[model samples]
Structure formats: C-alpha cells, structure tokens
Target: MHWGYTSIGASTYKGFDVSYTDLIGTFGINFNLFNNDVVRYYSGFRLGLIWRETTPFPAVGGALGFDIKLSKFYSKIQFYLGMRLWTDYREDQKNHFYGDSSGYKRGLITNNALLQENGAIVLSMSW
Candidate 1:
C-alpha cells in the first residue's frame, strides 16, 4: 500500500495513497510450493514514479520494493516494501546551465531535474 502525508500549515496534513497486485495461479503454476504449509518468498524489481503537489517541495521519485507471498490452498496474498533511490522533482537549480559552456557566454545557474530519495509499500490478494 502506498501512502503520503502533505503538511498544509504546521500540524495539519493531507494524505493519500494507492496500491495493487496480481496473482496468476497457485497449484497450476510452476512457482507454487509442493507443500500446503509453505509461505513463498519472492523477489523482483519494482519501479514507479510519484507526483506530489502542495508539498514543501514539488517532487517526484521512483520506488523499488521486495515482494513476498503467503499462501494456503489455491489462494495467496502478496506484500511488498521497498525504497526509492532517486527524487522526483526539480527542486532547485543546482547543476543547471544558464549560459554557453564554450567560454563564449555567461552560464546561467539553475536546478536540474535531479533525482531524490523516496519509497513505498504495496500488497496484493489473489488466487
């Protein structure tokens, strides 16, 4: 499940989030466990971008999380938790070029669309 809290003034915050998951099959799938009492641990890549407004800083960031599945019979539910390694907004003009770089013109200072740090968690139910 993804969630975020936006601070309106000082002690107030507006928050929201969303998440989804998919499960193809249980016993018919080769990835299924041979025993019924098994809880399967799975790992894959997670990638997504988020956009937030009215935030202290307008930012964007991608997320990465690990996934695990708990199963019984033919039904299973998966949960994910991970972190993002980059930011999502152009917060400031850090490495931005404002002018020419060939020593011909004055270079302008600006913030490039640099990445930021972000993360999220997710869960899914399937059979």
Candidate 2:
C-alpha cells in the first residue's frame, strides 16, 4: 500500500492555463520474480482512488520494476525504479464548446476517461 500526490499544470486548447492536484492511495501485492543479496525483481497490480479538484475517481494500474540494495550492511535500504500505467475515469460536468466557426452554440456534458502513465524512481529505507 502507498499514498502519492501529484500536481499538474497545462494549457488548454483555448490557450488558457489550468492547474490541478491529485491525491492517490493504492493497495496491492507484489510477486518477486528473482532475488539475491544485491537486487530483486518484482511486478504488481494496484487498485486505488484518485482525488482531484475535490472529486473522487477510480484508478486501476500495474507496475513492473526492480530494487537494488543500496547499503552493504543494512539490507533494508534500497533504490527502486519502476514503470506504472493507469486509467482514470471521471464525469465531465463543465461546458465544452467547439470553435466559433463550427456554429455550435450549446455546450456539451460528457463522460471522460484519461490514461495516465508515469515512472517512479525512489530511495527507501524500511524498518
């Protein structure tokens, strides 16, 4: 289980800037494919919730990575690197309009789903 936070800023098609933050919590299990005194390889699945702009959405993803022992005497300290991919689903309640040349005046509300992918590089000490 882990908790993570991310802040994103981007420009929209209308040339406006917007920013938002996401709070995420995940619970999953990992299976070790290979292990030794210096390094270990593993893969896992994740099911979690993502809270953005005070709204909660569901997220599901998986990870594949390895951990390298960083301390010779303390095996609990390690460096981790991984690749993760997930899908986030949410409802779009705001107005969305086409370009002025399209002659579309009314806005549309629809459901939106986003695919989020990221990599993690971390140094951790476990008790």
Candidate 3:
C-alpha cells in the first residue's frame, strides 16, 4: 500500500486552488529472476485502485527492481529500488462562466481523459 499528497497551483488561476490526496493499494505476484546471499532481482504485475477525492480509479501496472541485503542476521531487512508504470482513467469537473447580459452564467464542465505513461520511483524496504 502507498499513500501520498500532491499540491498543484497556477498563477493564471488566481482564485483556483488545486490539490490532491492520493491513497493507493495494490496486490500482485512477484518472481525472483536472480537470487543470492547478497542481492536479488524481481519483476511483477499489479492491479490496484488509486483513490483521489471521492472517486477510485482502477490501475494496472508492472514493476521491476532489485534488492540488496543489509545484514546477515536480519535477512528480512533489505534495501529496495524499483520503478513502476501504470495507466488509469480520470474525470474532473470545472465551473465556467461566459459574459452575458444576464450576469454570470454557471456551467458544469466535465473533463475526461485517459492517463497513461504514469511512472513512479519506488524506494523502500523489504521485510
């Protein structure tokens, strides 16, 4: 499981403040490609959900990385470095108004897009 927070803002959108809090949980199967007393390499596929705001988007991805043993007495302790790539669908809503004689008009605009080429660096411990 992974959890993170992100904040984004633009000077052009003075009155608009955009931020995101994300929580992600994944389950997958991994296989070891190389294994030794000091190091190991593995690869895996993952299926998960990314929760942003009130909606949860389905995500699919793969990971590849290696781990280095930190101590012989504590074999469960390992340093890990990995990379992941995933894709998901996201929808967002925006409010817009146009100039008119009837004052400001409000319209709900929904933006939908397929988000791809999303990558994250994984630096963590293995137990």
Candidate 4:
C-alpha cells in the first residue's frame, strides 16, 4: 500500500496554453492479482484543469480511472499501460495550422502523439 502523486498532461492546440492536466492522488497495491507476477493496480481520485478555445475559463472537473502495470522478467518484453477517463478535456481537439518556419511547428505536433481528451483511449507502449 502506498500514497503517491503523478501528473500527465498535454498542451493546447496552439501549443501555448495547457489543454489538459490530470493530477491524481493514487492508492495502489502490488500483488499477484493475476498470477505469481508483479502487478500493481492503482485507483485514483483526481483534479482536472482544462483550457478550451471557446470557453471563458478553464473547465474544472473530476476524473476517475485505473492504471495497471506488468513488469519484470516477462521473458523479454516489458509492458505498461496508462489509460484514464477525464472530464472537460478535449481528446479530439485540433490545433491551428502554424507556419512551418524551421519545421519546429511540425515537430511539436508530432511529438508525444497522444490524444489529450477526456475518456478517450490513449495508449502508450515502450520497449
């Protein structure tokens, strides 16, 4: 059992304002819930701050989600998943077309290609 804090967020379409923020207080337990494996299951209560182009103020909301991890000696592959359901966050929000001066704008858009939205499936995989 442990108490911890973690945050994951994405920038607005303009790449200026913060489009979404997920700051969660997590209570997790590590056990062999599935097998004799090291798996940690997490449940979180969270505070969310969101910025939209049309709204006067950043939308405030609450989010609920679970995170699961499977690590260590899985033959060769290491797998981790971080998927959350949020409120007032835009997952399908499109950014404005910025001028490509030095390919900087193009690079920024492609970096971390995860949809910053509420309740949308954002998948992350790494080796």
lDDT of 3 by residue, 56-107 (tens): 5555544444445455675655666655554433332222121232432232
**Candidate 4 residue-wise lDDT, 1-127, digit = tens:** 2344354555445445444333323232323355533333334444334434443323333455544455555544556565555434223233432233233322222342222334644343334
| lDDT scores in order | 0.30, 0.42, 0.42, 0.40
Best by TM-score: 2
Error of 4 at 97 (Å): 20
Model 2 TM-score?
0.50
Q: TM-score for each prediction?
A: 0.28, 0.50, 0.44, 0.37
Judging by lDDT, tell me the better candidate of 1 and 4: 4
Taking every candidate in turn, the Cα RMSD to the unseen true structure, in Å, is 13.6, 8.9, 11.0, 11.0
Pick out the ten consecutive residues of candidate 2 with the lowest summed lDDT: 90-99
lDDT score at residue 85, model 3, on the 0-100 scale? 53
Off by over 4 Å in 1: 1-61, 76-86, 90-114
Positional deviation of residue 91's Cα in model 3 after best superposition, in angstroms: 3.2
Clashing pairs in 2: none
Winner of 1 and 2 under lDDT: 2
Candidate 3, superposed: residue stretches over 4 Å from native: 1-16, 34-74, 93-112
When sorted by lDDT, best at the front, the candidate numbers are 3, 2, 4, 1
Better of 2 and 4 by lDDT: 2
